[model samples]
Target chain A: MQQQVDIGEVVLHHAADAYSFGIDPYFLLEWHAWEFMQLGPFNLTPTKHVIFMVIAALLVFLTMRVAGQKLQQQRANENAPKGFANAVEAMVLFVRNDVAIANIGQDGAKFAPFIMTLFFFILYMNLMGLIPFGATATGNLGVTAGLAIMAFVVIEISGVVKLGPVGYMRTIFPSIPGLSGPGAVAMSLFMAPIELLGKMVKPFALCVRLFGNMTAGHFVILSMMGIIFLFGHLTFWNWAIGISVATLILGIMMLEIFVATLQAYVFALLTAVFIGLMQHEH
Target chain B: MLLALLQEAETHGPNSPFEPEFGLIFWTLAVFAVLYWVLQKYAWPAIVGATEERERKIARQLEEAERMNAESQAALDEHKRLLAGAKEDARALIGEAKTVAEKEREGLLAKTRQEQEQILERAKREIEAELGKAIAELRRGAVDLSLAAASRLIDANLDDAANRKLVVEYLDSLEHSR
Candidate 1:
């Protein structure tokens, strides 16, 4: 089905049933009420969701493989590292030492491989959206929220192990040390709901933040690009203006690329932080 | 709250505006597991192996450096030993030369003293011989003078050998006193 909308207004995304408009400044907010990929039986009915996930995974693997091959060739001298390998090495070290280790400490090292993988995986997926007909997997709340829940589960499990049963309860109730009186008890009681909210808020915020940043950047670039199509087939003014606009959009697109990578990094970083906080006293 | 939102999105149902999402949980799990497995197996090993190789190379370089340092130290010690031995040999040669010069100086001094003593002895002998010859000649001359005086004074013929002998003896005594 085809429909015509306003000329100046932006069309953020086009899906099967409905389309989205530009809103939520940070990320393009869109949802499909239906399942695109239907799972086939003995697999007769296949769903678009599964297809999308597989495609996302493959793209991630290929990009990283290209990067990994480049890394090895650079390391042959091993003493002298160069090019993409150097860039990748620098990123790995930063995430490993500066972000992961610094935030998560010794216990966090176990998750380093997975966290690094997640960052690269999300990063590649978000970048693919710039291509024609590609979807942003990270832009979906269901996807981001699901990933957040995994982080949540890991966080809870890690906290439980570190804090023990009584210690985990005490975390939810942080009364001032050496307070045993009724007033102290009351204050602890008052803080419980707020602490609970904060706990729930962590994953919600993570979902929104990743989804928003990735989708918003994509939407803006798409809208800016729509300017070229708006101009007619042949005219000198159209050429000048269209070229200039396209250049501006490309410049903005470069900024979006940086943001795409950074958002992935931040998501992983915050997940580490939340987990670490749970393991620690404060 | 869940039913209401699901219903509202569904109400626009015709070319059904909102289509229900089914078993996202199941496919999501499968894809995620496959992703985790593939990544763990294929991608990570390459990176990890390369990293280990780099580390090994660094370690080898360090070991080589240490070996070179030790070799240099041993060479330096050997060179120092050779230099000390050469210095000792030079000192020994200098001492031997000094002793030989001292012996030569003592021999030259002894030969000069012996030659000087011989020259003085010969001059003394020559002087004594000359003195003896001159004394004898003087005694002979005195005897001759005394005899001539006696003959001129007597003027007669009756003098004998005894008289002549006495005159000679007297002249010898006179020469000795003078």
Candidate 2:
């Protein structure tokens, strides 16, 4: 008898956040959500994505802490860092100089820590999904939205701090050049919603871009893997298809790694740009 | 078949990626907040501070190196200038010494020549005087011999002063003729 493979079920099961961790036919660890704390309108249950998020956070914190310490030690010794510390330093400097400072101008260094944290945290979360028995926390919409919302808050707050309340209002209601009186006022009124939408869109794009890229990569890999088992019988064609699909999946996995890093960089870069734009409105 | 699969995926209602799970968002916020707070409190300061310090140190070192290079170059230029001045001074001193030595040698040579000429003139005057005296003595001896022969011939003594005067007049005539 040919085994039935529900491709959609397999893909959804792997791609979506779940309250249980499963390796399928080998091991399964299901969580009882009711056992966890329940606040008003909030369930503090540890889902697969949440657990992965913690792992990612812990990984980032510990690694960065070590890197930070090593950096301090290297500074004290007045010598360059080596190996992992060096790599971390390079990344930190890149985010500081290229991402944050490059986008945000002189005051960008103040925002470097936030940008660097977002980058590494998102990076680790994206990478975790590729590992066996690991789920991508960033693949979840809620997680990406949370990150985006935080970034949005930072961007807007920085803008507010840099440009006073009146100046921030001017950002929404920009003065049109060469036009004054009623014309400029009409232009400002017309541009106001657009400016506000533009503000919201920056973070929205950051959220969806990251979430989509991560989730889509996993979907493609799972769908490709599903193709091999789609044929009912184990034949020569099936083995050939399996081999081809595996190769394709490997290629995609490589691309996914690149995409993960790219998405992380994009998010950080866009956030920096938004902060910069807010600081310097014209 | 793919469309059917997608439709089937859509049927799994709660699993839709678009569906916002408040629990997951809350967890994300909590985790991210904690991570951010922890990192901001500890890791970021060290990393950023160290990196900035390293940058400042590198810039300072470069500035120091440039300054040192300029200082060394200036010192080298000063040293060269001093060396040139010393060389010029030494050359002038040598030239002066040569001129002084040349003048002193010329003066000593002139004095030595004058002394040699005077010695030659004195020796010539002395030889001439000695010759004149020898000649006078020889003439006196000849006259005395002549007088003695004459007296012997005459076989008598004549007046001494008159005879002497006669013999001197004869000898003067004979010397004049020779």
Candidate 3:
């Protein structure tokens, strides 16, 4: 009897975060959850995603640092940067000009660094999953949520600074034109929760959009590949199916790479837009 | 297969995508915070500062170029004005010189005419005086010849004063007749 392969289990196992880092078929580094660092409801354990997150952070840090030094040197000599430094400068300028200032207005220069950090960090995390034996840190809901929350904080704080306390309150409870007395009060009370929900939804959308896109791309690729193993035995039909699916996977991977870059851009762009929205009330 | 996965997903609660892991979130926040701080402090300043510096340098250079252009333009205008003024001055000088030369020529011509008139008047006066002298001398000789002729004809000497008076009267009569 041929044993059937459970594609669902395989996909879920690969998509989800694990304590073990699997390098190859034989090499696997198992990590035990840190029991002593349990504080309240949280267990601070080093997982696969955590390791990748650290790697991504380190990469972003080193790359930016080197690029920054090169830029400073080039500027001193009154010369343009070349190669890797130029590429990094291009990205940095795009985020500063197109994403930050374009959306967030003239005052967007202050938030450019934060937006740049988010963009590169998310980009690196997304690309990590595409490589062999590497996991996507951004694929995890928690990580995306964390990033979204930070963006949310920056957005709201920018509003508070721009609009002030009273003006910020007015954003949530807006006064309609030509409405007076009790009617205006009633309307303001009614619109408050909706306005607050609108604010919350921006970050929520940012979080789910990144997480869903990254996870779904991986899921589709894995499931398609798993289809070849469905036959259980290496028959001619199975081999043919495997070759066909592998070709399809290649195409999907190209799309995934595009999506990875796109999602990072979208996240940064939306965050800037949200910050811009907060700067001025409609 | 979808149903089977749903059932399996329901059983596997911890590994589910919807389930939140506090530890993962904590780590993410920690890593991100460190990244943001480090980058904001060190990396960003160098890159962004250089960009701003370059922009400032370009702006200043443009301003300087504009200033130089304006200055050169003003200088060119002044030079053109000076050239026009010099041309005008030269024309005026030539016109003045012509007027002076014409006046000097007229003055010289008038002086020459006055000197020519004076010389012609003196010559006329001298010629009249000489003509008067020559006529007197000729009259004296005519009287002498007449007396000698009369003496020879009469073969005697007559009184001179008496004959002279007669001769003078005869001459005066002759002059009146011509």
Instruction: Please give, for every candidate in the order listed, the TM-score of chain B alone compared with the true chain B.
Output: 0.54, 0.67, 0.73
Model 1, position B78, has a per-residue lDDT of: 92
DockQ winner between candidates 1 and 2: 2
Q: For residues B39-154, what per-residue lDDT tens digits would candidate 2 score against the true structure?
A: 99988777777668777899899999999999999999999999999999999999999999999999999999999999999999999999999889988998888788888889
Off by over 4 Å in 1: A1-50, A63-86, A226-237, B1-30, B48-178
Scored by DockQ, the top model is: 3
Off by over 4 Å in 3: A1-3, A76-78, A232-234, B56-178
Residue ranges of candidate 2 with Cα displaced over 4 Å: A22-26, A74-79, A232-234, B1-15, B56-178
Against the reference, the lDDT scores of all candidates come to 0.66, 0.86, 0.88
Better lDDT candidate (2, 3): 3
Write the residue-wise lDDT of candidate 1 on A1-282 in tens digits. 214433222332232123332333555445443444435522212234345556878876765566667766765656566676667666765675566667887676666666766676677667766655555666655566667776777777778788897788777787767778997899888888898888888987887888778766765676666666665344667778687888988898789788888988898899888877887754
Q: DockQ of all candidates, in order?
A: 0.09, 0.35, 0.38
Model 2 clashing residue pairs (backbone): none
Lowest summed lDDT over 10 consecutive residues: which window, candidate 1 chain B? B13-22
**Candidate 2's residue-wise lDDT over A1-282, tens digit each?**
567887777887788777787786699888766744787766677788888899999999898899989877886899877888888878888988999989998888788888888899999999999999888888888889989988999998898889888888888899899999999999999999999999899899999999989999998998888887776266668777778888999999999999989999999999999899887885
